[model samples]
Target: MTAIDQSAVETLFTNARTHNVWKDKSVSEQTLRELYHLMHFGPTSMNCQPLRVLFLNSQAAKERLKPALMPGNQEKTMKAPVVAVLGYDTEFHEHLPRMFAHNKDAKSLFEGKTDFINTTAFRNSSIQGGYFILAARSLGLDTGPMSGFNNAAVDEEFFPDGKVKSNFLCSLGYGDHSSLFPRQARFEFDEVCRIL
Candidate 1:
């Protein structure tokens, strides 16, 4: 396959920045749905596709999420147009029969294996979270993904049934670029990768 245009690459990665401040614009529910539709195609092991999302967009919803957020994250989350609580389904394997249809025994690989289930759930959900960010950027939205929060508190508040577990929180909106810090540095390919 041919490479995507450089501008698309810039939108998804090079020019994208983690935004903490937001402009006074709202993210429509339709946009959120579109974003998920775009991101959900990212591949996962056994096609487990475990990521689940809860978006806080109202004052009451933000207030309910407040106590679970870290002090440093509370203001940004409340002010952002949308705060996405990204999580994973504990029973994600139950869907393997349909999602991993090529392999009828896919669910059996995870069933009754507590440690394996948790690891797969977290790992695949994290992979999907990366897709979520890129999809948002491609749609001209800004993202601020942060992990400074109480996992148990979030799970209790939003996933009381214990069927899902929170992984991270990401704020989505039109970013306030005036307040952005300078872009940070990264290591060269050789510094972090190896050819086998």
Candidate 2:
């Protein structure tokens, strides 16, 4: 496959920033669906695509989510046009027969193994969340991924069934970059990576 143009690369990563301030623009339902359709193609180990998302767009939904947010996250999340409750399904293995057709034993491997199930679910879901952000950016949206929140409260409020668990919260919309904080420094590649 041909490499994507430099502008596309910049749109997805190089120039994308975590936006805490958003404009008054709303993210339509269609856009959210399209975003997920694109991000779902991102790979996961054993095809255990466990990440689940709840998009809070209405005022009532945001109010329900308010108590769960930490003070620092509350304001930005409340103002953003969309807040995605990124979650993972502990029972994701149940879908393995359909999702991992080649491996008939995939479901059996995770069904009785609590530790392995949790590890795989969390790891893969986290990777999918990264894909979600990039997918949103690719669609001309901005995202503010924040972890400063009460996970237990969020899980109870959003996924009370106990089947899914909250992973993180991401606020999405058109960003207001005029109020953005100065960009922070990142570690040099040599300091963070090694060629084997």
- Stretches of candidate 2 exceeding 4 Å from the true structure: none
Per-residue accuracy of model 1 over 38-85 as CA lDDT, tens digit each:
999999999999999999989899889999888988898899999999
Poorest lDDT segment (10 consecutive residues) of candidate 1: 68-77
Give model 1 RMSD, 1 decimal.
Answer: 0.8
For model 1, which pairs clash?
none
Candidate 2 lDDT tens digits, 14-90: 99999998899999999999999999999999889999999999978999999988887788889999999999999
